[model samples]
Target: MIHLTLIIVDFLTGLLAAGAWALASAGGAIAAVVGSGILGVSLFRRWRRRD
Candidate 1:
């Protein structure tokens, strides 16, 4: 019974860790996309001003 409980706890911990990792990954991806978009727009505006 103790072993089974330990196993369940370990499994739950792993699931939580995986979920946290996925959330961090998604957040990083969104940040990258938004950063790039802002950079692109800024560059575009600069180029247009130069022209």
Candidate 2:
């Protein structure tokens, strides 16, 4: 019975860790998208002919 409880606890911990990792990955993706959008606008303006 003790071993069964330990295994259950380990499994639950692993599940939570996986969820945290996934959330972090999603946040990083969002940051990358925003960063690239800014970079794109800056580069476009740099190459654009000024009046």
Candidate 3:
């Protein structure tokens, strides 16, 4: 019984770690996309003003 409980706890801990890693990866991707978009818009506006 204790061994089973330990196995379940280990599985849950691994699952939680994987979930956290995926969430962090998604957040980082979103941040990169948004940052690039903002940079692009800023550059476009500056070029437009010059023209």
Candidate 4:
């Protein structure tokens, strides 16, 4: 009985860790896309102003 409980706990911990990793990866991707977009717009505006 104790062995079975430990197995279940380990499985749950692994599942939670995988979920957290996926969430973090998705958030990082979104932040990178937004950051690049902002950078591009800033550069475009600065270039136009110089002309």
Candidate 3 wrong stretches, greater than 4 Å: none
TM-score for candidate 1, please give it.
Answer: 0.96
Model 3 lDDT per residue over 1-51, tens place: 999999999999999999999999999999999999999999999999998
Give the C-alpha miss distance for residue 25 in model 3, angstroms. Answer: 0.1
Evaluated against the true structure, the overall lDDT of model 1 is 1.00
Query: RMSD, model 1, all Cα superposed?
Result: 0.5
**Backbone clash count, each prediction separately:** 0, 0, 0, 0
Pairs that collide, model 4 = none
Q: lDDT of each model, Cα atoms only? A: 1.00, 0.97, 1.00, 1.00
Candidates' TM-scores?
0.96, 0.78, 0.98, 0.89
Tens-place lDDT digits, model 4, residues 11-39: 99999999999999999999999999999
Decide which is better by TM-score, 2 or 3.
3
Worst 10 residues of 2 by lDDT: 42-51
Flag regions of model 2 displaced more than 4 Å. 49-51
